[model samples]
Target: MSDRAPQPVERRLPTEESRQLVALVRDIVSKEIAPRAAEEEEAGRFPREVFTLLSESGLLGLPYGSDHGGGDQPYEVYLQVLEELAAARLTVGLGVSVHSLACHALAGYGTDEQRAAHLTEMLSGGLLGAYCLSEPASGSDAASLRTKAVRDGDDWVITGTKAWITHGGIADFCTVLARTGVEGPRGITAFLVPGDAEGLNAALPEKKMGMKGSPTAQLHFDGVRVGDDRRIGEEGQGFAIALSALDSGRLGIAACAIGVAQAALDEAVAYATDRRQFGRPIADFQGLRFMLADMATQIEAGRALYLEAARLRDAGEPFSRQAAMAKLFCTDAAMRVTTDAVQVLGGYGYTQDFPVERLMREAKVLQIVEGTNQIQRMVIARHLAGPETR
Candidate 1:
């Protein structure tokens, strides 16, 4: 238990309401989330109740339309809330982002009747949802997915496995992507399948380097059946839908990354100032002071990058390039900041006695999830160079 305070990071919210929302989120994080984060994560316990509290507080649907039981907040606000939550615990913050990703397909593409039927339950009915897209072999190349959804009169039978699913076993619903036509991206279709659908089973959660409290598992869909009403968008529109969702999800990742970096920076500064070296604080040294300064600078730059992307999204402008850029820069920044945080604490940082070690481990995952930083570079290049020659 290092007595390190989380470093302060200023936010540029657009409204008083958004500021209030961030305040509410911070209050909940400090009181309910931060206290149990280290203990529960060490025990590999998912804080399902915390999600219930978030749902009750209307934090779950912050960026969604109010018409369908959502908060109607802009992405700019919702992402900041995510950053505050992540500062306390990455599992909860990332969980909310994944839930929002799961909701995107139906919210953005489902018919009005479909929205009326399922969106309310999903958004406000205290249901937790998982996004199912990655397959065992298709981590970076999503279009190469092997899951199959065959049409059967009024129903579709989905069969195959989804890998690295968040909330895999406990989610109330799963927004699934399965191939229905020819090879490549166009064959994919999206379905909102019930979590407990017969023949749909989740494997045991994966043991990981960090963020152990968040369940990540493989899901097996063995002849799981869904009706036409469950389908989202036209046939072959799923890849596009999934891509659009990732554009937003990447921003969520960027925010979460900065939160981790900020937490690390706070820990390092607190430890350096309090711990004595040569009868004085080590922070007084120019070498350590420079490290702290660089860490703080990187975290601020990452926050600014994500907020720019978020603003573009709120304005309904093309933001995919910016989203990719933010995801790449922020996550890389988190990795650096967290690693530097551990260095700042020296031996104390390496031990479980401090949270910086955990922060470092957790920061590694953000670079890989949603899309690898390499994949982000590819996306940015495509945006800049107008797609690569085949």
Candidate 2:
């Protein structure tokens, strides 16, 4: 690889503050995150301290309200920060995204009392959060989830398991969805449960192909009880809340995918310029040069796509369709670009000595999480042509 440091990405920020925010993120990444990423990831160790630092630095709550201990920045700016963090380490970037997702219900649907009670600590107090919506059987068809929340006077008892939870065992709080009425989506209700609540237990984290540093596990709620005050929105409104959170969460994923892709491209470019083939650098070859060009182009396009969606969100316009499209396109592009980066490195790319292989594995999950690309396409189609009839 080239000895020179990789140049910072050029960004269009609406204000000098946002530009400075990006610079701060980069400084933290260089000093704290990037250096230890490969080692910690290889050891399957999550860097919780880094998250604490991020929280203290006001990086954890950028897209939320300033009154609630958030930065009140636009989604456009928040997502770019995600991209920078992901470039340094996917674990940190995606962990931040999941934390924001976990905070969504309370921020958007909670009463003033609820926000006052918990939002600030959750946002900037170094407390981590997790979102619980998927069950083992209800990954894609979330409306059919079977977790039940039975009424116990002024309290509710939740019973069932949530699958594929990020930060499952470590989160300080979880925004959980459980069935509270009849079957299907309308039956669900959202509740903010303390992670250490009685009867709330986490399984061992899943063994994954990538992002091993970030835990993904199942949480079992065995009659976990919370007061009615913990309920987020109207009774039986959890599904809507979940879907709304996902519209923004998908954009976060899109940004992160581009970050991983960009990192892979940078590695490949550096290696190509430095590795001699025959009598000259491999980067000078026509075929490899074209591949590098395509990788850069795809990364740029994905960045633009996600930024446009973020802008729509910032403007308070309907952005769900664009969000779905961005999620779909950007993740696919990440997979492609990372794979091609591997090719550009020849046999060396397959080894753990380089980061591209890990990036490739991490990119695969982006297409599956939040909602699968298939789900994203269906969402877009529903927006374009309405829901399909059986």
Candidate 3:
């Protein structure tokens, strides 16, 4: 690999403050995140302190409201910050995205009292969070989830397990969805459950192909109980809230995907230009040059797609179809671009000595998470052709 640092991506910011925010994020990534990413990921160590620093710096709350300690920045600006972070280290970027997703319920749907009580602390008080909607048996078909939350006087007792939860074991709070009335989407309700609540336990983290630094695990809510005040929105409204959150969350995933692809492209270009074959840099080869061109183009397209979706969201317009399209195209493009990047480096890319191999593995998961690419296609198709029926 070349010793040169990757050039920073050029961004169009709405204001000077947003420009400075991205600059600060780049500085943090260079000094704090990128330097330790390889070693920590190889060691499977979670960087909890890094998250604390992010919270303290106010980077954690950029897309939420300022009234409750958030930065109240536009989604377009916030997604750019996420892209910069993911380029350095995906664990941190995706962790931040999942944290924002976890906070969505209360910030958007919670009563004034609930927001006053918890939103400030969650957004800026160094607290981490998790979102619990997917279960072991329910991944894409989320409305089929089996977690039960029964009303018990003033409290709701929850029982069942949540699977594939980001920050599962260490989050300070969780936005959970559970069945409260019947057996479908309308029967579910959302709750802001404290992570340390009695009977809320996380199983051992799963070993993964990449991003070992971020823990993904199953959370067992063994009759976990919380006051009715913790409930978000009206009763039997959890699925709608979860779906709304996901529309935004998919954009986050898209941004992260583009970041990873950009990182891979940078590494490939560095290696191709520096490594000599037959007394000439491999990058001079027409085939390899075209490959690099394609990679760069794909990354740009993905970034543009996600940013468009984010701008739509910021304008208070419906963006679910665009979000799904962004998520699908960006993740699929990442997988392809990362694979081509590995090909660009030849043997070097296949080794742990380089980052492209890791990028390849990481790209695979982006296609699977935040509603899989297949699910994204279904969502887009629904928007175009209406819902599928038997």
Per-prediction TM-score, please? 0.98, 0.99, 0.99
The candidates, ranked best first by lDDT, are 2, 3, 1
Question: Candidate 3, after superposition: displacement of residue 319 in Å?
Answer: 0.2
Q: Candidate 3 — worst ten consecutive residues by lDDT sum? A: 1-10
The residue-by-residue lDDT of candidate 2 on 189-266, one tens digit each, is: 999999999999999999999999999999999999999999999999999999999999999999999999999999
lDDT leader: 2
lDDT of 1 by residue, 1-390 (tens): 346655445778888888888888888998999999999999999999999999989988889999998999999889889888998999999999999999999999999999999998888788999999999999999999999999999999999999999999999999999999999999999999999999999999999999999999999999999998999999999999999999999999999999999988888988998988899999999999999999999988888899989989989899999999999999999999999999999999999989999999999999999999999999999988887887
Question: Candidate 1 or 2, higher TM-score?
Answer: 2
In candidate 1, residue 245 scores what lDDT? Answer: 96
Weakest 10 consecutive residues of candidate 1 by summed lDDT? 1-10
TM-score of candidate 3 against the unseen true structure: 0.99
